[model samples]
Target chain A: MKLTDTFKTAIIGLKTNKTRSALTMLGIVIGIAAVITMNSIGAGAQNLILSRVASMGSNNIFIEPGPWSKRMEKGSMMQSMVEEANITSLKREDAIAIANHPLIEMAAPFTMGVGRIVYLDVDKKSSYSGITPDGQKINENNVILGRDINEDEVKSMAKVVVLGFTLKEDLFGEEDPIGKIIRIQKTNFRVIGVMEEQGVQMFQNMDTYAFIPITTTQKLLLGTDHVKWIIAKAWDEDRIDEIVSDLRLLLRERHSIYNPSGDLAKDDFKIMTQKETADILTSVTGVLTMFLSSVAGIALVVGGIGIMNIMLVSVNERTREIGLRKAVGARKKDILNQFLMEAVTLTFLGGVIGILLGLTFSYLGGVILGNMLDLKWSAPLSLDSILLSAGVAIVIGLVFGIYPARKAAELSPIEALRYE
Target chain B: MAKTTEVIEVRDVRKEYRNGAIKTDVLQGISLKVFEGDFLAIMGPSGSGKSTLMHIMGFLDRPTSGSCNFRGKHIDSLSDDELARIRNKKMGFVFQMFNLLARTSVLDNVRLPLFYSGLKGKEELELAKRAIELVGLTDRSHHLPNQLSGGEKQRVAIARAIVNNPEVIFADEPTGNLDSKSGQQIMDVLQKLNNQGHTIVLVTHEKYTAEMAKKMILIKDGKIVYNQKVDHRRFAKDGFEK
Candidate 1:
């Protein structure tokens, strides 16, 4: 028989028992839907993280005051606590040294603190960062109003601050707040500039910080001569590795941790390039997606078993039909093909419906998440995942259909015809 | 007029079925011959093994200890697929239950055997229509089996049997489930096909039904007790009596 004829016969058989066929397809439908939903959501999350990391500036690097292994090694809680007290070892001079390197374009040493800012009747609590003049350039901060802090401001330890977009909105709310004085802690500082709006990154709202000159912050606000971390940009992307090595050499020389064999555990500081951070984020999300999809795959297995169970029952119910076909000149292979085609058709229909349902759910989910996280969310429908899921469904049909098809083919026409 | 070509020839055929420790001999070395254009009826009581012998003659069951031939070719030596090909191309069957596929239209029911005939769609339909017309079911081709009366259902079965233009048709109690009127209509159709030169082997327990055939064989306890030509005068005369 022609393949089309076999498929047609299979279709007729399924159409005769429409309710039973649909019920048999339920497991596969849920399984495929779960798989597609997880795949799209996982891809969307990875894309969001990648774009956020990219927006933070791919050519930039971060240098923090701690050994690389301090956070990674187990049972180092006491060691990290002791190290945290002396973390003030990285001074502003080290940032200047790294900035002077030919491979480095700009460097800004900064520290973070949370404080309340009072402007008129509005007093809001927000995070504040101390950065130098070059911090605006390295962090991609654009001044929408007024001027950024200059070299003279840093030299004079000027009591001026730049408000983040969200902070400006909170205190002023559609009013011009540039040059307005805001009280930070016990000191009063004039807002010199308002930074352009930067959206959420890594789940943290980027438009919420107020920036002040590092010199003023260290001298008057923090009362510390040391900075917490240094952010730097490379002159060119290709020279990032060279600039990182130069910073590592300069920081090690200045900090005087001269264990020169480059054992990262013994080093007093950690330098991480933007690429390294992105790679770490990718790996973390990748593992998380894999684990989640595997849990969803369990549903697919259950669905396949359901298909097999229903196929066996169908074969039993249609024994006389099988016998009639055989008596009327149907070969064993024909019988097998008919039943197998029925199974494939069932799962294929289920897969198509599942994909549509999965896509719908994913789109709705993306919209809800986008609203909650305050980011633009797109439904991530990867063609590869769709194709893979379809392939899995077909293979499931074939594998599960085999035993029942064989049972049908192996039946004797006499016995089957005689079967009540 | 007797046709010289033998459609089926069975020799010393024996069929024994085993169920674990119990063994029952269904047919003990039975032999028979059915020629082309022959309308032969095999009659016996229940459990007489006539059905088993008919099954073996039709290549539906393999005899345990003898040879069966179709058109001078040994059937026991043929593979299962080969047997299926022979059944599809040269043999047709009608069952006592009027074994039309449930929920299937009369046209499609008649067209079932032609699916294996490798005939193109239009040609298969044309042939199916001719067979349905032959069985006087042209107006009822689109009706399902459940929607038709017992006689119409049996006619649909007859149409299905002849759609492939098989050289022989094996009918096992083709009218067994129908009333006398429906049974007489089924016998008339079979008689018309036999007259048109198609060999038919019918299995039945009714003596009147057996008398409609050109030859009759009576089997008792797995052995043929009577094999002879039917005397047309001994049976009741009907309007279309030969």
Candidate 2:
């Protein structure tokens, strides 16, 4: 028998018991849909995170004052929170020493502290950052309303401050905040400018921060000279490796570490490039996607077993029909092909429906996730996902349908005709 | 004396069935011969092993210990696929149950054999239509089996049996499910096909039905009791006698 006829006969067989056929294929439909849906949503989420990481400038590197612990391997927010109290290893002198290199753009020593800001009658607790002009440049911040604090201010130990876009709004409420006096830690400081609106950077909401000169933050607020971390920008993107190694050697020489073994575990400070941060985050999302996909894989196995069960039952139900075909000159191969084709056709159709359902579900998931997280996300349907789902569906049918088809082919015609 | 061409030769054919430790011999050393263009009937009561004999002779079942030959090809040496090939090219079968695929139209039901015969779609359809015309079911060609009368269903089965133009047609109790009127019509159709020079083998318990065939064999308890030409061979259209 030709493949076309076998498929046609299978279709007719399925049509005869429409409800049974539909129910039999339902397991496959749900399985494939789940697989595709999970993968699509996973891919969308990975893309969103990678893009956010990319938004943190690609040529930037972070130098934090810690003894390079595994828990604080990268410059995640936890590093700064733990590094702030007594780690006096990083300072303005370190940034000054690193910024002298030809590959170096500028390094800014920075610190974070929370305090109540009082501007006339309005007052609220907010976090503040100590930044240099170079820090503002690396942060991609442009003072939209007024002038930014300059390098002379840092040398003069100026009390001038730059207010974040949201902080300015909350403190003044549409009032002109530039050159206005705001009290922090019971000391009056003039708001030099209102920084431009920035949503999220390095997983921190930058809109909620107020910036002060690093020296002023060290001398006045905390009465300490220790800085939490340093931010460095590289002039050349291609030579970031050489710049990182050069800074390591310079920082070690400045700190006067005598050991020349070059062991990272013995280092007093940890340095992380943007690439390492991006790679860690990418691997995290990759593992998450793989875990979810394996869970979906269980559904496919259950669905394939469902096909096998139904095919077995169908073989039993049509015993006499098989017998008649055999008596009428059907080869065992012909019978086997007919039944296997039926199963494969059923799953292929289910895969198509599943792809459609998965795409729809993933698009809706992306929209919902976007609304909740306030991020711009798109769920894309790639050729790889479609082809993978379709191919798996075909393989599932073949793997599950072979036993039943072979059983039908091996039946004795006389006994089958005599079957009830 | 002119010797006829023997289409089938069964010498000491035996068939047995085993259930657990119990053995039942269905066909015990049964020997028979069928010539080209012969209309043969094997008749017996229920469980007398006549059906088993017919099955063995039709190549649907293999004898346990015997030499069963068709056109000088030994059944013992032939593989299952080889047997299927011979069945597709040289044999046709009509069951008592009519065995038409449900939800299938009459034309396609007749085309079942040719599908396995490897004919192209158009040629299979053409041959099916011709066979349906021969069986006088041309008008009902597109009607499903559920809509057909008992006699018409049997005629559809006959058309299917002859659709591939086989050398022999095997009918196993074809009239068992039909009324006397319908049974007579089926016998008439079988006799007419035999007259057209196709060999026919019929299995029936009814003496009147078996009388329509040119030869009869009676089997009792796995052994043949008699094989001879029909003395008063009856015609189906003359009104069957009990």
Question: What C-alpha lDDT do the candidate models reach, one value each?
Answer: 0.85, 0.87
Writing each residue's lDDT as its tens digit, candidate 2 over A346-410 gives 88888888888878888888899888876678667898989999999999999999999999999
How do the residues A6-76 of candidate 1 rate in per-residue lDDT, one tens digit apiece? 99888889999999899888889999999888877887888888888787687888887778773533323
Least lDDT summed over 10 consecutive residues: which range in candidate 2 chain B?
B51-60
Error of 1 at B56 (Å): 1.7
Interface DockQ per candidate = 0.76, 0.76
Winning model by DockQ: 2
Model 1 CAPRI quality: medium
In model 1, the Cα lDDT at residue B202 comes to 90
| Fraction of native Cα-Cα interface contacts (under 8 Å, chains A and B) also present in model 2 | 0.67
Writing each residue's lDDT as its tens digit, candidate 1 over B2-44 gives: 4478878989888888999999987787788888888899999
Model 2 chain A worst lDDT window (10 residues)? A72-81
lDDT score, residue B83, model 1?
A: 87
List clashing residue pairs in candidate 2: none
